[model samples]
Target: MNEYDIKDTIAALATAYSKSALAVIRMSGSKALQIASKICFYANNENKNIENFEHRKSYYALIKDENNIPIDELIVLSTLAPNTFTSEDTIEFISHGSIIVIDSLMKLIIKNGARSANKGEFTYRAYINGRIGISEAEAIHDLIDSSNKLMAEASIYKMRGRLTREIDKLRENIKNSLMIVYGELDFPEDDTESFSYNKLIEIFIQIKNDIENILSNSKRVESLINGIKVAILGKVNAGKSSIFNMILENERAIVSNIAGTTRDFLSESIYIENIPFYFMDTAGFHKKADNDIELEGIERAKKCAYESDIILAVFDNSCNANDDDINLIEFLNTLNNKNIIYIINKNDEDKKFNYKIESGNIISISTKTKEGRETLMQALKNHTSDSDIYIFNKESYVNNREKSFLEMGLKQIDICIEKSISSFSLDEIAEEMNILNNIIGNVSGKIDAEEVINEIFANFCIGK
Candidate 1:
């Protein structure tokens, strides 16, 4: 059978197959209840089957093998057609959570008529049956894999059809604009009122602006979903590792007084104020490498600085700023405008270095005395916009798939706007509008729904 086909009964262990109080075996298809009926009998009577089992109700029953032998007592749940997750008859066997028990039950179900579900097949069926859209299917995955409450909340919003509604509204606006354009082209001699050239341009501009806003704010959504990367940068022996350990509250990185101790980037994910942050302890900056390994480490350090969303540039408060420190500051300037915080470490030590760096994003801290740690956290919070947990409260977060379609759509709209400004032919503009319609459809998965569905569900774990 094909991967997306839903004709055959599919079964899978929805819960983890480990020792627990209960494990759920999910089955969905036209023959799901039929298969369940063959294996499940009333707990009080082994010969009695679940032929008259009620829909949307749980039945206390005993799981049986082909010989009518009892295996385990389980709660059998049945949901009838047109109302289940896959919009097909569905059954769930809540058996005792034991590997042997689960394996036996699965074998019995398969023997009766159900096959193992492919990855995300159940959700795929839901999409194909019009029970859920592509975005909602993807949202199910996001909700399952979310690292924090904020990420889960965003996925919940999308699953509840916020994204679908927003995209549908935008597509409707585009279709209306196209209708106006087509009217002007088809009925050239009619005196009926239509949108003027300026009005069309205005509408296009507003749509583009809305798209741009979503894209610009996407970083916040991404950080909330995928955790923010914060890199610690400084010259050799600047106590960067110490600060890293302090932030992570563990000795994850080796702290030493030797220069250039960290020759490779070390990273760990930690939660700060309920927000996830990937704290990276990068190789310290060295002006001149003594070996090839050191040179490679320096390169990795530069790359980390380039990629990090927020940088913690450490400086020794006790020693004079060296050439490497100066070089690090200069290198931070060449980055893609990341938020840089100048941290003066060793504040407990006597002020020996002529610290001359100037910036409001500077804080002095001592890993020895645990000073200025709160301020550093506040700076990180501000840089990553952790204060605004409600960023996804109204607007839907754009996933990478949606982002690609959006960018393409925005580019075409910009082209249409340019053509409109140059007084291009109504037919030519109408052609662009037609292309725009397809692009919008792609964004909402209306044109390539099946392709999007496959790509999205393939990433999901089976039984979900």
Candidate 2:
């Protein structure tokens, strides 16, 4: 069968980089092997015939130079039509990773009629060929250039079609509730109900809990997607800035003897083992002169800590914990679920230690000499993380926009469940429950959420 107009094959350099020890040039189309076989230089005795070897197998071959002599030893792997990655036929040439060699080979293949594959085209083909679904294809896009292991696992989990299943389940449950509402209207004189009101309420309660559980972790998911933002905060000279620089492993922030040297927020994105973090060094939290320009910096720092995913509450280990530290601890406690890790800095030297605070996972660290820094990180990880797998391989981060809608739907469901159990008409409750379909429809793009959809999928690769 023919490929596209002027039909042939689709090829791409699959090794990821232009230069490596060897580059695998991948081709998939109706006539991939036919196009490749024309130019391939067979080196081994088994290479006499490209076909009849196997449908999905490799053959030793030599890719010839312009003069038709072998310039490179290549292992040509092919899958026959209808059963390959592209489901048409596929060819992969394991050639030298040298840029010149791969480029020359690709050019030669194109000259023989195969067009260059666009970015993500092969994976797209995998999706088209039923190898994966839309969600899995989306995950494949995240997998290729995932910066952190946690992100990779999340993508992998989503690509495995878990999210699609959940979506289907939720949508189906909503449909069942909607059906019950119509069933009541469809047959009022049946003397019996096809769906029980109590059962409907119970099912919806389960659904509400499911959504609530997903939304409960949505913030943490955002933190993982865009690495946890940690703020190192304390009064000036408490070594908060010093500890920020230490966690980052560089001169990220200036260290000075001056008490108010840092009056602005300085941040760095650092990887903690497999997890990523954006650590901020904030200005001292203290009253400043009315005319002090430095007070603006302190104001920003307060906002920074308030917005932070985690806070490192540092106190001067050289001095006893004072009212400033105690007050700050109390304020951080107000964030409810915020991860605020308390650290007594300068503990490397003898200083008063006040063990009065009830902060979880408190520790001592000396940034000047780098003492207990690793333990500090582990402690911070323990403090901030709700899961040991910070990458959240099992999580599909519902975006903030989606979270809002889901929360709204969940709230409606919560009310509906209450009304259902209280003997208030389920027809009214179903109306409330179906209201969520519009909200979820907006999320799933059952409605025209093209702008949102593009913004999301565009972050994915082209083929994905």
Candidate 3:
């Protein structure tokens, strides 16, 4: 038998072990309550038996060691089988958040017949016992590790089985299509319901379109989970660093009037409206670099802009457009599919810049006066808010694994459509449909392999 056998009663510290006001230690198994009863006693009545503790009700209790010596005072909640997270008899101890207290209680519980749970074992049990699907299991992990509000909301939607329901509906549609194909192949003479090739292709096209739509948002979901990278690019003395400081609301980058003062890029992450934005203040662009170091810095700046998701092209408003300014604009134009925001800095100075650019994403700001800061912030929020991942629109949001599976499913769909159009044997198309169904099942964990299930749960933290 495996070391993490589900039959063994398990105990673990559910909360962080740091010295806080309180912590939670949980146990689940057939003998969880029985083991808990051995180490706990009702605080109000020392003569009260733990077996008689009311389910789902908290009772102030006194924990004891092997020799029946008092350990600590805590509140214990008892729950019966088939109604808890793991679908097993469970007990939870809300105790003082002292490492020493937590360690003692864990040891006492083990000594009384409970064993320590392995990493993610609690959630593993929940999945194995059919309490939640694989998508919800992955969502639980994501929810715990989420850094931004958008990620948390997306994870919450997945945890509530939104993605599961969407996949189920898709699966049902595919199954119905397969049934029609089989009926046509089995009884060609029966004229009850004729199967039109155009009708079949239409259904397949709709399913393929649906899958592609969900797959399209995968990158946006990743950006929300991670963070959107924004690069600051401009000519020398264009106030790139100054604008960087204004955005961060800190003197993170050095502000100066001399050209080439910044020889390297500085990066800092900040949360704007609960969305994460990583801003990189790159070295200013120049046609002729004063030295090799400055030239290298300029190269790094161009590379940063190339790799960034958004670019803030800063221009000096106090001076007329020069070769460096025109060159910078041309370079920005060369980039494709980048969210470019033109920033006219030094608006506090006299207006001199008259370079015409045809873009609606332009804002004039003064780093000294802090003007247009709110508008710049609103621009960022607007760009990020366009992502569909933040909204639960009855569309499935997929992770890396699920996205790959769906892509494979889409390929199988294409093959099915091709076979149908070629007037090939319906058997071949049905086989492709079967392959697609299995791929979809893989996404929902309905027919997932044991190794895949283990790998999914392995990413979870211990004690869930």
What ranking emerges by lDDT with the best candidate at the front?
3, 1, 2
Candidate 2: which stretches are off by over 4 Å?
Answer: 1-9, 45-49, 64-71, 80-86, 178-191, 194-198, 221-227, 245-253, 268-278, 289-293, 317-334, 347-378, 384-395, 399-464
Worst 10 residues of 1 by lDDT: 383-392
Candidate 2 lDDT over residue span 1-464, tens digit each: 02222244678777665578887888887767677767775577424534443687877887775566565787888778677656678788888788888878888888888887665566656654667654565567777867877777776777676665666678788887787677776786673555677887778887887787676665566577678888888987898878987888888788999878887899888777656888889988774434466778777877888778788988887877766676677667677667777888897788886647764768878887898898987876764545735435455766455567778878878777778778787567767777876666544334354354345444544322
Off by over 4 Å in 3: 1-3, 221-228, 288-296, 384-396, 447-449
Error of 1 at 86 (Å): 1.1
lDDT of 1 by residue, 1-464 (tens): 27767788899999986899999999999888778888888899878888865779999998888876678998999899899889999999898998889999999989888899998999888877889887788888989998788789889988888878877877888888888888877786793465578888998998899778777666667766677788899988999999999988788999988878899999998887777888889887888888999889989988887778889999998899889889888888777768888999999999876858776488989998889999898888876543446675666777888888889989999998999898898889988977877886666556455665666777989789
Best-fitting candidate, scored by TM-score: 1
> What root-mean-square deviation over C-alphas does model 1 reach?
2.2
TM-score of structure candidate 2: 0.76
Task: Report lDDT (Cα) of residue 212, candidate 1.
Answer: 83
lDDT accuracy of residue 151 in candidate 3: 77
> For model 3, what is the error of residue 299's alpha carbon versus the real structure, in angstroms, after optimal superposition?
4.5
Writing each residue's lDDT as its tens digit, candidate 3 over 426-454 gives 78888889999999888877754667767
lDDT of 2: 0.72
On lDDT, the candidate that comes out on top is 3
